[model samples]
Every structure is written in structure tokens, then in C-alpha cells.
Target: MTENKIIIKLDKDKKKELEKRFSQIGLSMNDYINLALNQFLIQGKVPFEIKSPSYDISTLKTKKAMLKTEEEDIGIIKNSISNSDN
Candidate 1:
């Protein structure tokens, strides 16, 4: 298979940050970018959505609150069961 090269410019800081993230995920920058491009070509769009950290933190808080509410409800149900058994 013939190979082609593509060149693009990025901010140095952003490139460094992307390299760090790619390293953490055990992929080289070249491989990661190529995978993304291949996916975009096949799907006709970027494969993933970029989300803000604040959004992620808010979602986490919401999930925790829901879990706490469910736990409280379970405790109330258990108490009612025991009370009825008396």
C-alpha cells in the first residue's frame, strides 16, 4: 500500500498537551491523529464530542445526589418493612 503524508500546524502548548494525553492512553500522536482522521472520513464527522470539565463535574454532582436520594429511599423502605413485621 502506498502511504501519504499530511502536514498541519498546531500551537506548541496544545501539541504538548495532546502528546501527554496520547501517552497516557498508550497511543503515539501519529497513531491517535490517524485514527481520528480515519473515523472522520468513514463517519463524515468527528467521532467524539468535546465536553468542558465544568460540565463533567456538574454531571458527577448530579449523579451523586441521585444516588444519595436513592439510598435514603431504600433506608425508609427497610424501616417500613421492619415496622410492619412487628
Candidate 2:
């Protein structure tokens, strides 16, 4: 069988994260990616669910409010960390 090469770019942090995850699962990064691609080819679609977030108004409002709360919490945590370092 003939082989070909494919080059893809990944963020350094993401690459390291994936390397760790695949290692825990006993697969190399190349092997995991190839397995995903092969499954897609055989199934004619991704091997996972693809769905859009429900666009109902209440859902959107709740999500937005939660995100804002999370942002505030993150800011507080950062400030506390910086204060501790001082």
C-alpha cells in the first residue's frame, strides 16, 4: 500500500493536552486521529453527535447570565491570587 503525508497545525497547548490524553488511552496521537478519520469514512459522518444549541429565548437568557456570573467569579479568583502573591 502506498502512503501519503498530511500536515496539520495545532496550538502547542492543545497538542500537549491531546498527547497526554492519548497516552492515557494507550494510543499515539497519530493512531487516535487515524481511527477517528477511518470511523468517519465508514460511517459517512462524525462518530459523535452534532447538534445546535436550542435557541429558545429563555435558554439564551439563562446561558448569558451564567456566562456573566462565571466571568465575575474568574475575575475574583484572579484578584485573590495576585493579592496572595504580593
lDDT leader: 1
Cα lDDT of model 2 by residue, 1-86, tens digit: 89788897999999999999999999989998899999999999998887667877788999977787787687843332244555
What's the lDDT for all of these models? 0.84, 0.83
Q: How many backbone clashes does every candidate have?
A: 0, 0
What lDDT tens digits, residue by residue, belong to model 1 across residues 1-86? Answer: 89989897999999999899999999989998889999999999999998887679888899877787787687843322244555
List candidate 2 segments past 4 Å from native.
52-86
Scanning candidate 2 in windows of ten residues, the lowest lDDT window is 76-85
How many Å off is the CA of 5 in candidate 2?
1.1
Model 1 error, position 30 (Å): 1.0
Please report the candidate that would top TM-score against the real structure. Answer: 2
